[model samples]
Target: MLNADTTDPAVLRELIAGELAAARERTGRLTDCVEDDELVAQHSPLMSPLVWDLAHIGNQEELWLLRNVGGRDPMHPEIDPLYDAFEHPRSERPSLPLLPPKEARGYAHDVRGRVLDLLAASPLEGSPLLDAGFAFGMIVQHEQQHDETMLITHQLRKGPAALTAPAPPDHADRLPAEVLVPAGPFTMGTDTEPWALDNERPAHRVELPAYWLDTAPVSNAAYQVFIADGGYDDPRWWTERGWAHRQQAGLAAPLFWSLDGGQWMRRRFGTLEPVPPREPVLHVSWYEADAYARWAGRRLPTEAEWEKAARHDPATGRSRRFPWGDESPTPAHANLGQQHLQPAPVGSYPAGQSPYGVRQLIGDVWEWTSSDFHGYPGFRVWPYKEYSEVFFGPEYKVLRGGSFAVAPVACRGTFRNWDYPVRRQIFSGFRTARDAGEEA
Candidate 1:
């Protein structure tokens, strides 16, 4: 199917089923990589036990697809509270009465089998949930999202490497210093994207002044210059709150980074090596990104500016669904789906460049934006308000573009992910931006 064809029910069904299977396969791979003990253990206070997420994925699928969309009675309704994320924070999840790894796998597989049956038999229309198979898409995306979380856990765990992938493709050609995104109005969000989450809704036109954005994500080499220049010690570059947090949190460098003698070394999924100078810096909190931009005499782009850089196609006078084009991502276009397990070097993926010749906007690293998380104009609750509504505030900073750890199923130009400014556990990075007229 070209896209989620709500008009053609059969095509939608096929699309839903395929994505469901793909997500499940990835989930299974991620969970099965570790032992039952590891699955039950919470690798970090910020993340749930892998087994909890495994069962929760199934629980959500049963709740949304089986019960809400198909009108089927719940299979394990009694255990719903255990997997309810809102009911318990990540720090306490490992202590909960979660199913063991085997049981979790069985429960998820059973739910998947039943969901498939429902998908085969149910009508794909008549309600908002069923229309265009939104519920199925949501479930698929949710599972894939949890899979990304589990991957993060893998990164945090102290052990032998649990996953492996070939390195991201490299580009020898040098990238431009920055790209000019001419000032213009562009639709900033999506009204028609089948699986776009609530925050990215109500397609609104936003007029923005011309800006210059880094052609690629900030590389480790560049970030090191900031660090070597005493960027961490200089309070002038940071916001007051950021400076306070930097002292309180004792953040001297990006997470997982250490200065070994004179060389900067980093741990990646249990492997340690000298930081790759050419690769985009990873695991940087939004605060650090903002500070780096300020130190460099620029600023992080606002959410709208980031979107315009990623989605707006000047020649067509329309926003494409991705940086490269409307078509879904592939290995050739971007480093995504944990295929490389790390960001590709800067200047890689010329094929994925935006119309203005900006590179790697859709993947490699989730780029931090200056905007806070908020609902678009005309945003409304769908399925549940807790997913997007509760988190809309200045407390959270918005990050655009999926990271290498992010699944393509859960990412789009219109897709929005947010977290606290101090979070660096996530595979996050940023590219600096400046007003078009700013001095370089």
Candidate 2:
């Protein structure tokens, strides 16, 4: 949402300040909803204790904006190693000496207060980190990403439902099952986005063959059919690696799902309910997505293909920053920013559809693509390489679009998310794509 168009420093200050405030507000809500003991406890080995994230966000802000950019000394330098993500894995974090919930909150708030003061005095230009308020924007994004991580911790926590929101609106009309995306060249990455991280840089052109993409993300009803057809048992529907993982992990269905009284039920945030027939399937691993696509005689879209479907507007021969256009997301455009606890129905968010009439391309659940997590041509490390560079390899698969847990500041057409192929604890889903043939 932080565009490169702002030249007025005062307005830029206000914009950056507002986004930072919004992120902190959400962070506060997610942490404050639970008690101190809950914040300190690691609900799952896959996630860090919520308290670590609370103070870490502040530590990163202190390291970057306050010290690196603002020339201020670290407020709590002795605890830096404890909060460094790379220094300690999520599973081992709880054993480290961590700040308590109250102290973490105070540290984060104090860091924020100082950062805002720095924002007011800085020129916000003339340097790569300060130009377009990129550093501040990055910190805001970093915090929001942590906020999403904390929300996932909330989901992983065992308790009564601690979160609630109104359901997404229904789309009155049914949508077609597929939309045709013509084969052509489209820009694959962004060189101009103010806050776009290093990986989505050095804009380059990519050519893709014509393909038919699902009009909406694969729905629970459709995925149920796959499960019913013994999709998980059919080795033919899975790649060798996928089959191996499926068997090794005993993956019978999406995470949080169970069968009860012949009804498909799932635990959401702590409440068990029948799987919503029309919502996009959630918490599926990339391999499972691939297997499901194979079961349906289709395939997961390539990263380029997914981007084209979400961004390219052939009529104008240009790409938009989001499926709906270059504007920041609104509640009506997509189910983003924790606005809803789960995905909207498949046919919903008509306004959020891409030019090709592809719906839910930006949010609801991150759609897995059949692509490796490698950088594009001319990709260069910025600020630091550890954020993305260390993860570049076939060991990880890429996921496109944001999820309902995503903050709008961290979600955009060019945004890239990657996770290990077998990991499904994260909110993830997929829509199938097929090559065009005589059916076209």
Candidate 3:
């Protein structure tokens, strides 16, 4: 299916079921790579144990698909408190009575079986949940998100390599320094998108002055220039808060990067290798991305500007669902779905470029924007308030596009991800922008 259009109920059901299976398979692959001990291990204080996530995925599936959709009684109702996210913090999850790996896998598998049977028989005409298979989409997106978080935990775990993939090829090129997004009004969010979350609701218009955005994400080689020139040391390039954080944290370079014997090396999934200069830099904090932009005499694009760059087509005056257009992403279009362990070299996916010739706008790295996370003009709490309502504030900064770790269903043009500005453990990078008429 090209999109979540409700024109054909049978096609919609098939599409949702296929994507749901794919998401479950990805979660299985990630969990299977590590030992059972690793599944129970707490890799980081900020994340729950892998086992918690495993059962949490199953719990959420049972809640949404089984009880809610199929009108079935809860299969494991007593364990609800153990998996309630808001009821427990990440650091405390290891203490909870989480299901063992074997039990967790069986529970999730059982839930999937019932959910699939329901999908095969359920009517899809009424209620928002069944409208174009929105609930199934939500579950798939949720599971895939946890899969990405699990991948992060793998990165943090201390062990021999548990995951492997071929390296992304060097495809960087001397493209335009910046692509011009003309001054005008363009549709911002989506009202018609069947599965759009609350934060991206009620598609509206945003007027932006002309600006120039980097044709591709900032690369490791480019970031190295910042480090060599003392970008971290210079207070002028950093905001007062950022400088203070830098001083307190003693940050010298992007997380996982170090200069050894005059060559830059990085630890990736328990393996150290020379930094791939052409690849988009990953695991940098929003503060780091912001400081890099300042050092280079540019600024991080606003969330609106980033969206316009990715989705707006001036010729048609419409917003597409992706940088490459309304078509769903394919391997040829992006390095998504954890198919590759690392980002493709900047400018690798020419086919994925936006209409404005901006490349790598869909995947490779989650691109940080200058905007704070907030609700749209006419936003309303939907499905659940915790999904987005609790996050509408300046406490978090928004990241756009998606990373190689993100799944296609969860990485659409309107999808939004947010984190604290100091977070660097995530798969993130940035591209700088400037006012169209500003001096270079």
Local distance difference test, each candidate = 0.90, 0.92, 0.90
Error of 3 at 298 (Å): 0.7
TM-score of 3: 0.98
lDDT of 1 at 210: 92
Give per-residue lDDT, candidate 1, residue 353.
90
TM-score of each: 0.98, 0.98, 0.98
State the local distance difference test value for candidate 2: 0.92
Ranking by lDDT: 2, 3, 1
Pairs clashing in candidate 3? none
Worst 10 residues of 2 by lDDT: 167-176
Compute the lDDT of residue 403 as modeled in candidate 2: 95
Residue 99, candidate 2: alpha-carbon lDDT = 94
- Best lDDT among the predictions, by candidate number: 2
Answer with 1 or 2, whichever has the higher lDDT.
2
Q: Which regions of candidate 2 are displaced past 4 Å?
A: 438-440
Colliding pairs, model 1: none
